[model samples]
Target: MEEYIVSLNDLKKSYGSKSVLDGVSLHVKKGEIIGYIGPNGAGKSTTIKIMLGIESNYQGEVKLFGQDIAEDSIEYKRKIGYVPEIADLYDNLTGFEYLTFIGELYGLTPQLADYKAKNLMELFGIGEVYHSRIASYSKGMRQKLLIISSLLHNPELLFFDEPINGLDANSVMIFKEIMTQLAAQGKTIFYSSHIMDVVEKISSRIILLNNGKIAADGTIEELKQINQEGSSLEQIFNELTGFNEHQAIGAKFVSIVEEM
Candidate 1:
């Protein structure tokens, strides 16, 4: 069995009495792609932020590459590739320039960084936009740029938050393919998304968070066994997180609005 590349124990976080994460624990094996799913306020992103060292106020035991993140944050962060929900690239910079900047931030040599940036742009089918200023790029192009920036350093672990939010269908497929390929080469990936079908397709395991705590953790088949046969990913997700209740009410409200 592969060793765990990331682990959390009794993790807790709160935003001034509004508890965001409560006693969440998880383990991600090396080379495994783990999908983190939850509702809007379910603490998925909070946990990810804590792990990334973006939120120091958080209280927990988070280890990256078996090193305590709270203690060795800078060192731990160097081993991670992160793609945030929002793209914050410099609009005036070309795609290639933006990636080179990110690479430099990680202390890479200019020539090596540029070379890696060029290769990543070509690999992700974004080479055509390499010279175009980010301000002129479309949403999909920006997302592609963000992805390339996060990956330029070849980090051992990748963290993506809603990675497919603005991607086209083809781009989404490419992203999924790249993720699996990376994992096959002994990289760990942790991503958070509301899209159940994609998670079911790509993740080696899924961790469902509900109301600031972990609801379930297992493979698709293991989660499926929690309910009867033939249960879909969406069905299992709603059943475990109790999200179906709100969804049903929303559906009825939409129906009533349509009648008017």
Candidate 2:
């Protein structure tokens, strides 16, 4: 019997008059690479926040490793790794220092943290800037540092939001390889991204969220069956989410200005 690493039931959140999540439920099993896809304001981040115990004021239950997260938030958090969209880091700290700080917070020894940080920085091709202040790093470099920090603790469950956002082709390929390797090692990963191609190529299962609700959840073929579009994940996404790229307000505005 496979263990469920993450389980949510009727998870919901609201801010003032606006409800961000509405009865969202999901379950992730051990060694599963679940790709969570949704457009802007579709409540994807909210769900992740709740799961990570970053936002506790929500309705419903969250469980990790078969233990209730609400009862033991810190314990559950220690077992999970998170890399958010905005890779915020301490400007004054060097890349190595920042990673060391996070590892210590997770109870890793200073020497061990430094060792892991060095290897990860090298693997991500950011070792040259390991001693540089985070403020001096580029967007891609900062993103890589953040990923290294997340993995320093060797977490059993990982949450990645746009993990390859600023990465180049080679780095992106490396990340995909790492994700596959992690899954093969019996670790569960929750990947959230707007990149349909990456998700299609890597995810063992995909969950599509639309209007704060689950529109589809299954493998690529199953999703195609649901919408009857066998083209690709991109086509299935557009058809199911009803998000059109061609119809843009900026494009229409520019056209009107040109005509005038």
Candidate 3:
């Protein structure tokens, strides 16, 4: 039997007749970097929150590492790492202090976690801020700390939603390479972002969710076939989501601004 790192069967969610996910089914294998893309309110983050056990009251089965998560499989989380779009940090804690604390929660020794955190911070070019309080760190520095914290445990599967929000160009390049290397080593990665170019380059497969369901799911080349008239993923996305008013919207926004 083929092994799947993540499997969702007939997943559905709603809020007072407003459907967020409608019969979504998927199976992700090891060593695959999946780009989960969609417009705002498309349930992209909702699906991830479900997988991470942060949300509930949905219909369907969610299995991780071949164990049903709905059934007392909480221990499976140890093998998973997640970097959310916006996460709360302990502003009072220093960078190293917070990272080591998080590491301990994941069952790592304080010494080992600090050592790893130190090296990661140094590599990201924020070594000097290692001992600085998180409240004093800049936005980009905090983002780098979150990225490092997620990887400190060396998880087998990872979920990254807008992981490079505040990273600079160089840091973004390094982060992209890191994802490629991790996937090459048989780690699964589910990356959700609005940045189509990064998704196009790093993802082994792309899954597009529009409104509340999987409108498109396939490799980059295969998805291109869906929109044969289009030239890039962005174009294909616009077509799949029934959107092509970029120029019109831009012109209108400029005119509105000039009216003032």
Maximum-lDDT candidate: 3
Could you arrange the candidates by lDDT from highest to lowest? 3, 2, 1
Clashes of each: 0, 0, 0
- Per-residue accuracy of model 1 over 157-198 as CA lDDT, tens digit each: 999998888888888999999999999999999988888899
State the weakest 10-residue window (summed lDDT) of model 3. Answer: 68-77
lDDT of 3 by residue, 236-257 (tens): 9999999989999999999999
Could you give candidate 2's per-residue lDDT for residues 1-260 as a string of tens digits?
Answer: 65578888888889988988888888888999999998899999989888887887899988899988878867888888999988557999998888889999999999999999998898789889989999999888988887788788999999999988788999999999999999999989999998899999999999988877888899988887877855799888888887666569779888999994
RMSD of 1: 1.9
TM-score of each: 0.93, 0.93, 0.98
> Model 1: residues >4 Å from true position, as ranges?
1-3, 245-260
Worst 10 residues of 2 by lDDT: 241-250
Q: Candidate 2: global Cα-lDDT?
A: 0.88
